[model samples]
Target: MTSYVEALEHLNQTVELHEKWDLEKISQIIARPNATNIQIVGTNGKGTTALFLQKILCAHGFNVGLFTSPHLVNVTERIRYNANCISANEFGKVYMELRDIFDEKQLSYFEKLMVVAAEFFCRHPVDFVIWEAGLGGRLDATTAIKNDIVLFTPIAKDHSEYLGDTLEQIAYEKFFVSQYAKKVYSSPQSQIVQNFMQKQAEIYCKEIFFIPQVSNFYIAETGTVFDIDNQKITIPMLGKHYAQNAALAWNAAQQTLKQKFSVEAGKQALENAAWPGRLQIVQRNADKYVFCCAHNMHSLQSDLEVLKVLREKDILSKNTGVIFAVTRNRPAQQHLQMISKIFPNIVVTAANAQHPIPQELQQQNYAIANEFGDAVRVLQKQGIHDYLIIGSIYLVGEAYKYLELEVRS
Candidate 1:
């Protein structure tokens, strides 16, 4: 294909069905068993948590291949090796090698990417292949590869249509990744999910442990600092969730490296670890911007709480402008109302045209900005110096494009 986008378009011509997902064929195509697979499964925070783990492993000087889904900008962002995005040229070239498999096996869009990521990782000297499940774990394409260590992020009610409708059910579906895991780590989760995961581990005869509670846990306008495993860690991030992610990465790395790993290396990893679009901060002159990827209600609540704390500390202005967008399937109005409760004025727009046309926010203070430039214009005209764009990662990409925000390291 001429371009990665074109290759995807061509793949779209294939019918969408399970018959196209021949994992057996995919495995044979990229048969390399040198890499240890790490599957991170969750409803939210999986991307950030996976990045956390990847960053720590890289800091320890391990070759890491990381893959996450639903790219905001280029598709290459979904695949990386040692913290570097895979170039489209390389991605296209590798994918072309398996062109016949695409036609013969009928791999769907997501399945195609999974095979592509696996094949690319196999060709490299990657020591750790961190695969972040795109959705439900059991039937996810990544599940085709049995993981050596499985990290469970916070699983809540998301993708209910396919996964399940209830929290317990969703949690149960996600824990399937742990069935074959040699080791398992849990991020702080709801009581129901934590219990469900423990039960699953019992059935699988695998021991599962949650990230130990940190001592002297503190969140402030400056940053977050905590003590875990007798190690003092500081991450310059707003939320406690980030600190928990750091601990998960640290624990997982410790489990892998054993005595060779040092507390000092863990601290350095946490300090430098950052996942863009997750409470990401950007500045333009005197004005400031905070980009958060709050997709579902669970994540939205978490990010809102962070903002609440920031507002209370007077770090973030009590009043600000919001650029909000959500996927079409979700109730746009609910997100609008929730965001309105904080920032009354909002610019409602589509993150990308792929999203269903956004419903007009039927509020006197809200404006519809189809164009990113127009969205910025509305916020600028309102004299809102502090701006927050949230709801969907795709929307964050759109805002980043307009603002020219640099990609995170």
Candidate 2:
């Protein structure tokens, strides 16, 4: 695997999670970073929260390495040094070194990437390292490495097959990621999830801090403003949900640094914070597209709320329709129904051949397309200039590919 393409090909050999035996083995062999390890575990906002915290810490002049999953554009998105993704050459070089260990342990794709990130972070020593769990945290590959601080972004029911079927069962599984942490912090969550997390904290003899209520919040066309603990900060992204995620990052940074935390720096850092595939607006010639990664029911609902707010503010056009696609496991019909509430004009399409639109859905009233490009053409033919490409992250990736959008980081 001398090239990035080849490395990705090798990694795809095993896409599913295997036992942790391989992860445990890699954990022992990798040169672990001495930086404070913060594990982010939750169903949604994990990546955004991690990005916010990384930006906050980096703004305070601390070197930070962040590892996030399910890259929007490139594989290098999983590993970052000082918030910059590792270059393909560097990713391949490091991945090449671990080929033997990868094969020896029969490690899954995620496990292999986790080790690569660990090694990459070790090579580029930083003051802090943020590890975002790929899925439910307890048995997630990131948990294989001990963490000093654990942060939970709103827990919700997702990956029911692997986590559980009920909300309590799912939240219980995510709560374990904070068991070994010296300190635990979380964004606002449902009462049930909060209760379970509190109980878990008690069992671990740890104190868990929940981000305080937003003193005030406003969603604007430009961005979302949040007033927390008398600090007025505005994040580049829109929506109250994003404001809450920023609040979580703000509090976590304050607690992590205590006296060293700078309110001004943190506020400024959040203002510049941005995450891909979360209501991201992309312009393609004369047409405008908003790509959102609302794969599961929870995320789809949350994003629809944002979309509703946007529509009310005139930030999103009334004529803006949606291009919906999802993975095989997702509830496509349910997601389409949710989107239809705010966007009745939708075109159903598949992110890839492996996850095609269900046959039943193909017979529905909605317009159908073969792919993202076809979806866009279908909308354009109807004189719909503005579009919302909403569904799985892979769908956003496909849309980006169709637009030939380059990965900035």
Candidate 3:
């Protein structure tokens, strides 16, 4: 029997994506015909949206399995049942069972994880399986399975290399997975992109519903409240963007389970749902750190809006400093410029070799650190207790590791 450590070693040897393979054939090996699957795809908010939907369904007395990517602290975080991640022992057992098939199929790292999730869910049958795409919906491994319901978070221009350079191209790529879905829904997007998507849906003879933004909302220091269908829904997480995700989840849940929808259950689910590393606050000694995964330009704008609102409401200090980092593929200059407009005290750093400290960022008046831990040290020496750490998801993961915090559902 392969241990979890050995399984991870095998997975680490594989690449993130492969140019060619038969994902459908491999996925069908563990396909559960009765298991309803919801596939979510977007540039940002896929993980959070899936989480919100999972919690909502589970609260309504349905067993749900959630599969997401880029685990913050542990690989087990990718395969979750209801709200808890798959235990390491179970993960090792499943991985060992699939090892021979994995080698035969030449599966990529993501494909192996997807296979594990599919098999795990099939064995422990759930009412629904929420599959969050690892990349663009068209070629994403999650697409290999039949998506009973396909949902799209706000589409943006990130991952242009694989998806597309233009917004229309990106939207079309994400819409591909919806071709066979029983129902399709999306959050509000740019007018141009929405028009493009609508035209595409019409050509395919599939109707796509676009969810409107949450209108009635109140924000306090603790959380935000939104009035949905005259039902006061309160979520513990801050920001209107989170409210939008909750609203979308509520609408989707109602649509998916028309007669089964329970207001009390939905409210409880929304209140309990928590997404870490997005405006996540960590306390270490006397210092406080705020971590957010706003890697791309679109997400950065959304996160900054939340920060601005927090400052205006006096929930967050206006003098809060920020530690910024970026992957090499991202435009460092543009990100730094955007952050500088709102935050004067900025410290730049990198999480790993893939994300090198940009020369442009270093040339600025901002302080630089070799990595996330070093950045925290730099802030500590300067006596800056309240600061925001924003950038790549990898950076946020590093922050969690440095703070010795474990990520949970």
TM-score list, all predictions: 0.92, 0.95, 0.94
Clash counts for the predictions, in order? 1, 0, 0
Q: Which stretches of candidate 2 lie over 4 Å from their true place?
A: 15-26
For residues 1-409, write the lDDT of model 1, one tens digit per residue: 4866666666656566643345466555554437889999988778877887888888889999998987766777888999799887888887777778877776777778777888888888998999999778877778778789899878888777778899888887789878878989988787877887788788989899788755687776556888877777777766777777777878888888898787777778778877777887677887888888898888898888888776677667776888887775676777778877877878877777767345444443567888566777888887778888888888888877877776765
Candidate lDDT values, in order: 0.79, 0.84, 0.83
TM-score computed on alpha carbons, candidate 1: 0.92
Comparing 1 and 3 by TM-score, which wins?
3
Better lDDT candidate (1, 3): 3
Best by TM-score: 2
**Per-residue alpha-carbon lDDT of candidate 2 for residues 143-196, written as tens digits (9 for 90 to 100):** 877799999888888888888888889988888877789989988889988898
Model 1: which residue pairs collide? Answer: 20-106
Candidate 2 yields a Cα-based lDDT of: 0.84
lDDT of model number 3: 0.83
Write one digit per residue (lDDT tens) for candidate 3, span 194-252: 89889988887888888988878877766778888788887767678788888888889
Residue 382, candidate 2: how far off, in angstroms? Answer: 0.9
**Which pairs of residues collide in candidate 2?**
none
